[model samples]
Target chain A: MSKQAPVIAIDAMGGDHGPEVTVPAALDCLRQYPQLQLILVGQDAVLRESLAAHGRSDHPRLRIHHASEVVAMDDLPSRALRNKRDSSMRVALNLVRDGEADACVSAGNTGALMATARFVLKTIPGIDRPAIIVTLPAANGCTHILDMGANVDCSAEHLYQFAVMGYELVRAVENVDSPRVGLLNIGEEEIKGNEQVKQAARLLSSSYLNFIGYVEGDDIFTGQVDIVVTDGFVGNVALKTIEGLARLLGQALREGFQKNLYARLVGLMALPVLRGFKQRFDPRRYNGATLLGLQGIVIKSHGNADRAAFANAIRMALLEIDKAVPERIGERVATIFANGAGIHEDAPHTTRMNRA
Target chain B: MSKQAPVIAIDAMGGDHGPEVTVPAALDCLRQYPQLQLILVGQDAVLRESLAAHGRSDHPRLRIHHASEVVAMDDLPSRALRNKRDSSMRVALNLVRDGEADACVSAGNTGALMATARFVLKTIPGIDRPAIIVTLPAANGCTHILDMGANVDCSAEHLYQFAVMGYELVRAVENVDSPRVGLLNIGEEEIKGNEQVKQAARLLSSSYLNFIGYVEGDDIFTGQVDIVVTDGFVGNVALKTIEGLARLLGQALREGFQKNLYARLVGLMALPVLRGFKQRFDPRRYNGATLLGLQGIVIKSHGNADRAAFANAIRMALLEIDKAVPERIGERVATIFANGAGIHEDAPHTTRMNRA
Candidate 1:
């Protein structure tokens, strides 16, 4: 591997399909981006067998990092953190922490991934807790939303930090000068949400970030804002709800076309148009959800992600690595704290670092 | 009007188009249901003019109830409650309170409508606060979810109450003997959500209701559960996100069909199939959201509802009246309290009635 190549550690034993999906996705990434190097972490025998099947077991850009234990999809976060230190998920995260890889990508149990990532990599200074931010296709382009289920409960200060991190991510990755940020609330009215959201809105409004007041859930798809900030609980539900709706619509459309012979004929003729429309809002194209505020880049692919989706997640990690996202986020957060513009005076001094 | 006919008070000056939509919708409902009576509440002259335009000025089953003031769509809930005493929404709600109308339907500001209805009708006995429940199209049939936006901060007891209310509503309206109830959470695991959801899950597990354990957002459309209970904030966001996704898909489909002449021809040929799919998930068909736990039936129509949508809201009110939803919900809560099945021991004794 070239010395300047960006190295990504992959959890080969993660996700439903394990090495079957991750190994192929890693190879695809390596083929697509010649400079990209990947370390596939999994059981040595299984990794060798899977790679040998692909006819390039000795590929220069790929290597195997053997891990004895594999965290089960249903494992508790605390249990995984405590007992599965040698798990593939933990070893991949350890690679990032030890500077062996520029970033890491995993399609694993979300709670366990978060726990292991937080434990091994730690959070960036000035960020209370790491958040999961994902880009969702929208009307105009796409919108990025955060806290997609890392923390169940969050404070106003934590929300404010998410806004800053989301804004910085969009700016760095999307190449926008100043991203429009919005607090996701039930309504656009000033007095709409619970105390935390209302307080966060106040904090955001006082900040120098391009803080548009409040946006409802619809605004995420309307493409009226660039980054939507919300607590983990709401964000997670909204994301899953979106997923469910998309599946429902897709199924309904398929059923509609197969209703009769004439409709099937028309569906065949309309294939290109339908495919183009589907491509525009394809979930696989928008697969990776970055765990932000961590000391190094960590991308979480959906556990059921296909090869294309997993590759997209690797692409996201590559982009974050190329953009130096963590360094930029740490600097931006430090600057915000030093300036004391958005920081609340009464904001809790305790962060996850101190608490842990 | 027949002696047994249900009387519905309509807020004629509510919604975006006011009487332009509500007056026609009222006429439509009256025409459809021979035993239905409607009182159009609004500015006297404007409503009279609207009725005259619809050639229903002398309809026996329809009458005008003059409300002197109008609540602006953006008015704060407190302001609408304090100042708009004789506003169309308030007057219509008052008609329900006075037993002059069996129910009231309003396509006005949500917060104002909620605040005014709570004040005018009060919550049913054993119920603390009112909640908004609406049915959304799902895979097999439909699923009812609450509280869509009435109570932002909810306790475990409040969620338990919502579950009971939703269960009763579905049983009465949908004719389902025992509706499956699921608590909306970030994950389906026992340790997924915050303290409130966890406590609520325990409460539900011990209750007589058909309590399925926790479900994620996608389950709402999967039709795996009959009723999904969540706090106002998450429910509202999820519902709006669904709406947004629906709109986005609709637009994308339209644009896809209009892409080229060939595509347009295929769209024309496939129009029937597309229309069938659209009709199955039409928002207008699911237009009404009942304010559950109120002493009287109060249905809130979408603020921007067209005539068809407004008429659907009226139809929902009629169905609720036929089923005596408010009375059934009151009885259900009374029985739950009597049995002492789900009520938490340390649940706050202070209800919204005392606080309000």
Candidate 2:
């Protein structure tokens, strides 16, 4: 390619639909972002056939890289790590690690993707573990929720690191000078949550981020905070809970309007408005989950993501690349640890350090 | 007094609205359940005034049981245990413990209520800790979720106890012969969740309950299982997340239809349909969390619950009493532990107990 555009690697042989979605999504993203180059890492014949069907056989900026193996969704992390050396997912990450691409997007097995990314790119210094920060559509616009399914057994220090990393992520991507970050807990009271959560709150209060004291689960969609910090288990549960409820609500709404003739007529009249709401709150729009704390940007798309959803994942990776998120997080975390605040466990709430 | 009815004790001076909501809710529940009796436990003058305002002061079926002190929401559980000897919350549970009331319902401080209940009622044998089990609206019907905000640092055995207790509660209340019980986790795979969850799954599988291997957070609203079990931290976060997302979706729907003149016209036409939808998903309808594993039945209403919501909590308590839920659980748990499963911590998944 002659243009000086950002290159993003794609795991074309990932997800349920594989190339059927990824190849189209990559092409769609290239059309949207003029200064974008794509590297499709998968079996050559499968990608070529799909690209041929899409009538994009020879784009100037698109190149196909062949990979032999694929990681199945149910494959254990250990098995994936040991078995799939030259898999599409591994190859995509390898490209990013080699500085051949600015970012990598994958819709493969979450466990495998996280394991490979952590192993390949390694974590930024002062960051103990990597986190999967997924943004969901909230009352305002969206809220960045971290540790979706990455670190299950997080320490107080690990939680504090998540809060700092999440804070920096929101600031870099959304460009908020001081993003309001809330530690997800059962209640809003200062002394209400579990030990780890309570300790993290104390650590966050001592940091530079605009830390809003313990926000309950409902605060996630209340538009009160830009970022919510939680351990992997709780965050993963909360994110999936949101997705489940959204689908349930949509189905309920549809059935509620189809019961009677009058209701059906009302549904007809309300179609435009409902369509608008659907478009606004579509899960596909928020499909991409950024694998934060890596040396380079890596976007993890939903395993069942469609073309539009996979394209959105590419857009998310592009945004991270443009803002230099990893560097920003590294600098912020260095300051946090340098102050010796994050080094201690269960720091007393009374002696919280204020950002001056 | 003439009727042979179940007597429910209400903590009239608890919760955010105090007697304003509790008194009215008690009256409303009494009105709905013809043979139901209620005891208002609170300060004498306050109870009398609230009862008189509702014009039910002299009703024979309703009586005042005076308690001098009130438990504040922010009061530490330890302080509440040490200081509030005659608080309304404690008095209500005392009625149940003394056999004067079939069940006790409180909209008081959750921690204080849990502490007071455990101290006063103690736990049923074989049950390590009490869980906050609440039901939420789902697709086919409703789903029961436990450990809403109690026992954050749960052992695998504690989680197993919760599952057995929760499973029995569903069978008694819903009358499903063998309720499908799922261990709430981040993924559906056996090796997916954190340590405690995996161990709990093993314990559950060996037991007689229809243990569904692993269910994710989204599965809660899908109505695939009658009971979903998790530690207090994850369950509480999931419950609150549902509430928050429901509120956001409601607001989004309202705003979506009120966009333009035509949209407003369509919204007006769809008011009946929308009202039906709202009624079906009303949070108040799903109010009242049952504190399971206690020797006596203790129902916890949301502290911020209104009249309808608090009344629903009373209804929930009545249902449990009618079903003899605690006694049934007591018997079932005796059998479960008799198999020597409850005592072991981190038991291997394969050595799970068989029905034989």
Candidate 3:
């Protein structure tokens, strides 16, 4: 698979901007990666018009796949799954499921996209559910957090699975021989957190993985761990809270600079430095969230992503395609299960070692 | 209660800095509010030594209440509750329990403080648990979030009770006639969230309170609602994530300004504006988290709070005392129960109106 050029399916009619953003992003990805091929799945006429708007009727690496339906941003996942089989999101996933595309990218309704993808490409063997994993900027380098908004009510066994998946992904992509994985909890104490987290902590502790016990929320940015595993509800809330705070701080900084003439002059002088800081922590730079533990690769871009952010999502899919993350996770899970260290529902929780 | 001067019990031996921070903070509070009386609960000699170090032997408004024990920051709640009866934290709460103080402020182990406060003051009638409520700087004015780190697990009925408590607190303290209440969930859609949040949403919708349905994490800072309610685990994680992101951004901005000679020169000119911006969102201004639903007012300061932040916590306790937060919440709960709008354990989930 690595020998062939990477082929990605784009949900052209998804997200707030639909084909206007995804089409240009698809073209940008093709331009950046000469060996890349993209399948734009949407209404044929709309995609063609978007492509024409970009000064191209057609490209050798790009093909338009007709998808009659488009999932609305407010569509319920179950409704989208049952009704929108011909949706751009579903068609993109179908392309990947049929092995025509190495991966798929979509800036669509997250719930609808997840439902369609899961229905089309089922979870890998020994995996109960697929989790969304995203890389976030940290003090040292970066941190990968899983179950961003996937499974809401994850069991202890499911959290253990997320840990295994996150560990393998970090090891494979970041080239970390032993990625430090931490279970996200309210406190870094052995006795903190609810029953599920405590049980998950026990599972991670007994495993061969480089588990760094319970970590509090602040640890996510402290660069104390490589991967943070959490239930989707907590992870989603944390991620969105970060976004909200970033927005708030950004607004406050802008208002401060525009307060008065002297401050505005000083802000003018500080523009370059502030821009550099902004670029360093730009949400656009970290746009893609991968659906891990699936049989195939699917990257969920932020629904409001512009061309550049959508292109970044495509870049993520290409990287995952090159790394074969799913295959590696499968092998790791298989090895752990064969060693009788995999998730066992009936297994009693045990504390083997203190958290590092 | 309003006619009498407010007397606050202080846990002087709590938090990271102990007497070094609490003593000076208590003194500053005494100086700030002429009618305020403070009781410093700690080792007699240590309190006196701290007071002497601050160029004071005693003040007319300040009194020392010596305790034989100190609760360590790492002490388990159960252990602290079972054995540390003479601990500063317990002694402070005992003062409130015995009506020696109108309220109590502690920068101590949160678990221990909550556990001891619950055991001492007990929950208000019809309130099953006490929740920690903190006011946070938001896009417009400020937003209050409850269950900050109190109950790890919450039922739908418990969440309904939280909504009533939060609504009452915001109304009494912020002076909003109808505070917009929102239940924090993964998404704003009615279909989103786990069973607990969805069930809670139904309860909120049926209530007479200005209950906005489900709210996403980012809504906390959008100033879209006055109160956001969630289980303690999610609330704690969200709050910590905000702190982590803030610290990360502050460091990044500092590093950006110090990158070069030109940047540093611009940074010097930008200092006043930056300082103003920092003051606008300073965490110290929002230091105290009220333990709502308790029979007496209890304020929990950040364990690492310095003098300014601890003083802010005292101010928060004073504000609650002035507004009679606990009394109002108790009355509100009683009214709701009298109207049969209170939590019904076996109430079937009902959706009456679409979320506004």
Candidate 4:
């Protein structure tokens, strides 16, 4: 690990809330880690105004990147990337490519971000595709799920690559040396699920990754596997369903406790413990999803991320930078695959972070 | 509405907690609806023991129909139906066939139950297949989703018929007249989704079912549509996902509200209101899913249903009998393709419920 501070480039114009949430969160990140540096990528005017409103105009750690174009949420991915080169999303990816920052993070249109990242930075050597890796908070600890919403349609080979990439990312950043990977299926039996899942199971079982066999949808949060792999469509649905349920359930609990006077008193006595529990399951803490298999570090935040969520994304980027995750992932992937196996004898020099 | 009460045969030996849950629920149903008559079908000794425990050694409203054979949960539907002739599930459906009972309900192995129902108490004259319809509590109220796990493989025409059946069920029972029918797709656009969804959309748009075009996964809970239709596979995944989310979110909310003293005070104040809210979302209240399009009524309860859930299934069966839902569905389906439509209209009438 290097003493040099890692710089996080944030897409200030991304997310439903835009600079209002992103700016305050970046400031919070700076306050929490005084050693951290930030390059807010968006319209300079907007970023400056937000910083001034938050009473942090002349902070030594924060800077701005003037990206004039903004990608609308509903725009087509490829069209948006090709037509809007100076877009905040593209500019942020470019920052990582040019070594202007250690990592780039966005809470924008997922499709556009993935397309731009892949187009600009390209996939890592020996990596076929980049997967969106989300860290889910379970009872035991955090488990990583890949392809949250990157590739809606995937092949067995693609899923196999995703598992390997996911396993490496979890290992490198979280230090889970042998993260077990489970292929998501309708049932645990080999004979279950659609054609794609069946094919994925076969490939996963044959791959060198620590495959833990098939798992049902309910086993996701049980901490039975360190990495759960699936296609983006199913993965996205599963993630959003959890989010919706959390909101619906939270509201239900509040209503239940206040139904009567006796319950009200009990609720008051249990408030502190309940609050702690809420914080533990708070989606804000686990807001960032790494764009694994990319040549450089790219993290995606929730579209409606608030200040706390945005800060967590920055913190995640810093963690990845500190752990030299990209370099480790590249080495592991290159060695695991036949294409780059011959060159692995010479351990390539790790890409050093340069904070400006 | 007939002056004479409709007798519903019950498969008392079905479900994981069979006689215990089924017996109490039947008694609860009798108490709620004095006009309802129940014929409990199971082992004579076990049924007698259960009835005695419920303080009804010789209740006039309830009768026992003993059967010697049983169907295990994992038995193949076709094989089970062919072999288990004297099974409780089989006898219940047989009672319906012999005009001894108007309908039958079971919480047994879903596949075996569906198979037996299709084999003995067959499909209506115009109904090509039967679908499992479950009510989901949404923001606005409740949405009826069909084919939750009935038919794994279906054509666009099957989906179209499901919409009609679901719409009719909602109107007859839930009293939502002119119910909106939505085809569940990956996206809201008409062009989006797989071949089946697109083809179904075309058929639905032309049909008299008040089709609302394609809806995304999130729209299922918006209560924007009365019925959302899809194939069994996707529906099962969505249903299970919703259930899992409910459990996870419920736990998270309890923890969140009791986090600290001030929050606990708020939580206490909010307890009563929260309980009322939670009751509205209680899974038990929304447990029963009707196997629609069959000549005889067949209601399937949740696998882990308690007494309350089983009771709800009985209540659902009573409603079906009171409304003559099967006949209504049959009539509606008969007129659906009466203009010499190209699709097949060869539904059989088996009236058999092979209990597993």
Report the C-alpha lDDT of model 1 over A282-346, residue by residue, as the tens digit: 99999999999888889999999999999999999999888888878877887878755443322
Model 1 chain A weakest 10-residue run by lDDT? A347-356
Give the best candidate by DockQ: 1
lDDT of 3 by residue, B1-356 (tens): 37778889999999999999999999898888999999999999999999999998989889999899999999889999999999999999888877788889999999999999988877777787889889899987999998887888999988989999999989988888999999998872433798988889898899888998888889999999999999999999999998998999999999999999999999999999999988988899899999998878899999999999999999999988888888788777877776554433331111110000
DockQ of each: 0.62, 0.55, 0.57, 0.28
lDDT (Cα, tens digit) per residue for candidate 3, span A245-354: 89999999999999999999999999999999989899999999999987788999999999999999999988888888888887777777765544333311111000
Q: How far off is residue A78 in model 2, in Å?
A: 2.6
Candidate 2, pairs of clashing residues: B206-B353
The alpha-carbon lDDT assigned to residue B112 of candidate 2 equals 91
Where does candidate 3 clash, by residue pair?
A: none
TM value for model 1: 0.94
Assign candidate 4 its CAPRI class. Answer: acceptable
- lDDT per residue for candidate 1 within B42-160, as digits (tens), equals 99999999889988777999889999999889999899999989999999988887778888999999999998988888777777778899999999899999999888999999999
Q: What's model 3's lDDT at B217?
A: 87
Write down the lDDT of every candidate, Cα atoms only: 0.88, 0.85, 0.87, 0.79
| Tens digit per residue, CA lDDT, model 4, A1-356 | 35777788899999899999999999888888878999999999988899999998868988998999998877788787789999999999888887877899999888888889888777777777788989887646777887877776677878888888888778878787788899876531222567777788887788778899886566676778889888776676567656655665576567667766877777767766676777778889999999987767888998899999988988888888888777777767767775643222322222334222
Stretches off by above 4 angstroms in model 3 are A188-191, A338-356, B188-191, B338-356
TM-score of chain A of each: 0.93, 0.92, 0.94, 0.91
Model 4 stretches with alpha carbons more than 4 Å out: A2-4, A125-128, A187-191, A254-270, A326-329, A335-356, B76-79, B125-129, B152-155, B186-192, B249-274, B339-347, B350-356
Candidate 3 steric clashes: 0
